[model samples]
Target: MTPDLVLYGYWRSSAAYRVRIALNLKGLAYESQPVHLVRDGGEQHGADYRALNPQELVPCLVDGGQVFTQSMAIIEYLDETRPTPPLLPADPAGRARVRALSQLVACDVHPLGNLRVLQHLVTQFHAEDAAKGVWSRHWIGEGFRALEAMLAGNVATGRFCHGDTPSMADACLAPQVYNAVRWKLPLDDFPTIQRIYAACQALEAFQQAAPEAQSDAPAAS
Candidate 1:
């Protein structure tokens, strides 16, 4: 049975983009309920949204009357139910490798560089735009440099982060790459990551989830 899937997410959120990619990859249709994180003092903090997700984070997935937070958890639930367009690998080792790569971006890089964190640095710490950009580049460069080595030096790395097929790693990588571009980070150093990102962009799923293409995207500067 097809469940009622409503994704409460912000257009620019990488976490929300992950779930968007997963849904498209699985050929599942879902309602994209835009939750503006900045406008009107962050709609996510409002009583209505907080009722849905106490943590008040974007990319909240409501499936079959059950609300799920965390992009990875929501993607795993979709994978468990669908299983055709598998996000993880069939083998345990391969799955672990994929998850590791995914975490390299999601856990390590994203946490330090998300929108909320950037806002905090600027508002709370009185950081200027230049300082925020520096913060972004510092972490992205460190993370991408490490990822480039992993992808290029390791034999397991194929066309994608794992094997030839796109997996959870690709889902994670694409968003981080987008963030890198937004911050104007040099991609020349990480050729392998650039290559993988280009490959992922070729797919319709990634294109659809791109922040610029989202309904809530601000008019281009």
Candidate 2:
């Protein structure tokens, strides 16, 4: 039987990781269609995928022939369609806070460290791997510094990014944490984030949605 939802994404893409977490949280079954971002210079650049998403970005969700782009938008759509186990808070203020937190990572942070941007650093500016690592760590650390403050100062924070339930913010957060670890950015400065990340990792949904667990990820030796 075919699931109503189909997700197009690469295994390690933070954007796609957010969507995958959302789907798992909602307990929605979906077919995973792997888009190899680096193989043969990116399958996303091919004609068919570009037709589906002109932006040629991963984490494009196709539902009943309607295609949705952007990780945040896709997660919100899922929340709207499947109200149980809601991703956003009920109150307007809470929703705003969650959105703000989510955007802090998805918008302000992730873009600087995105694959294309890193590739462009090499192809355009001749940045070596060490230079690229420095660039990524700098931006990720900058973002994490702000994120740590926000989460630590806010009373709304709980076991998760929001009132103990795994909200959209956590979905956005987990991937950024993964990126931070991948870039070898020291996480000791952000205790709140570390705590929340530990909480998130304990969840089955997050575990299932992890990059290493994705079908397209290379098998361990």
Candidate 3:
């Protein structure tokens, strides 16, 4: 049976972006419910959305009768349930490596530049746009540097992060690099990551999952 799948996400969210890539890669058809994270003091903080996700986070996936929060968890759930065009590799070691790469962006780089953290910087610490960009670029660059080394040095890296086909790591990497480019961070030094990103973006799945292609995407953005 095909379960009803609805993704509640903000168009610009890196977490949500990763999930979008995952859904496309798995050839899953799902409805997108846009959560405007920055409109009118954030829709995610509203009573209804918060009730749906106590964490008040974007990128919650409602699958059939189950409500799932967190992008990585939702992605893994999709992989486990669907099983074709697998997001994780077949072997345990390969899966671990992919997961490690995924976490490099999702867990480490992303959190430091999360919407709330950026909002807090402005509201609590009075950080300007320049400062926020600096904060975002710093972590993104540092993380990408390590990721570049991992990919450039490893024989495991193929057309994608793991092999020729896109995996969870590619899903995670595509969005973070998108954010990096948005922030005007240089990708010249990370040639391997840049090359991988270009390859991922060229695919129809990734192109369709792009932020600009979302219904909730801004009129001018």
Best model number under TM-score: 2
Candidate 3 residue-wise lDDT, 1-221, digit = tens? 45398999988999999999999988888989999988898999999999889999989999886899999999999999999999999999999999999999899999999989998999999999999999999999999999999999999999999999999999999999999999999888999999999999999889999999999998899
Q: Candidate 2 residues 5-118, lDDT tens each?
A: 999999999999999999999999999999999999999999999999999989899999999999999999999989889999999999999999999999999999999999
**Prediction 3 TM-score vs. true:** 0.97
> Candidate 1's C-alpha lDDT?
0.90
Q: Sort every candidate by TM-score, greatest first.
A: 2, 3, 1
Please identify which of the two predictions, 1 or 3, would achieve the higher TM-score against the true structure.
Answer: 3
Residue 62 in candidate 2, Cα distance off native in Å: 0.4
Kindly indicate the candidate among 1 and 2 with the higher lDDT: 2
| Clash pairs, model 2 backbone | none
lDDT of 1 by residue, 1-221 (tens): 54489999888999999889888888888888999999898999999999999989898999888999988888889889889889898999888888888888889998898888999998899999999999999999999999999899988888889878888889899999998999999999999999999999999998998888888888882
Against the reference, the lDDT scores of all candidates come to 0.90, 0.96, 0.93
Output the better candidate (1/3) by lDDT.
3
Q: What is the lDDT of residue 94 in candidate 2?
A: 99
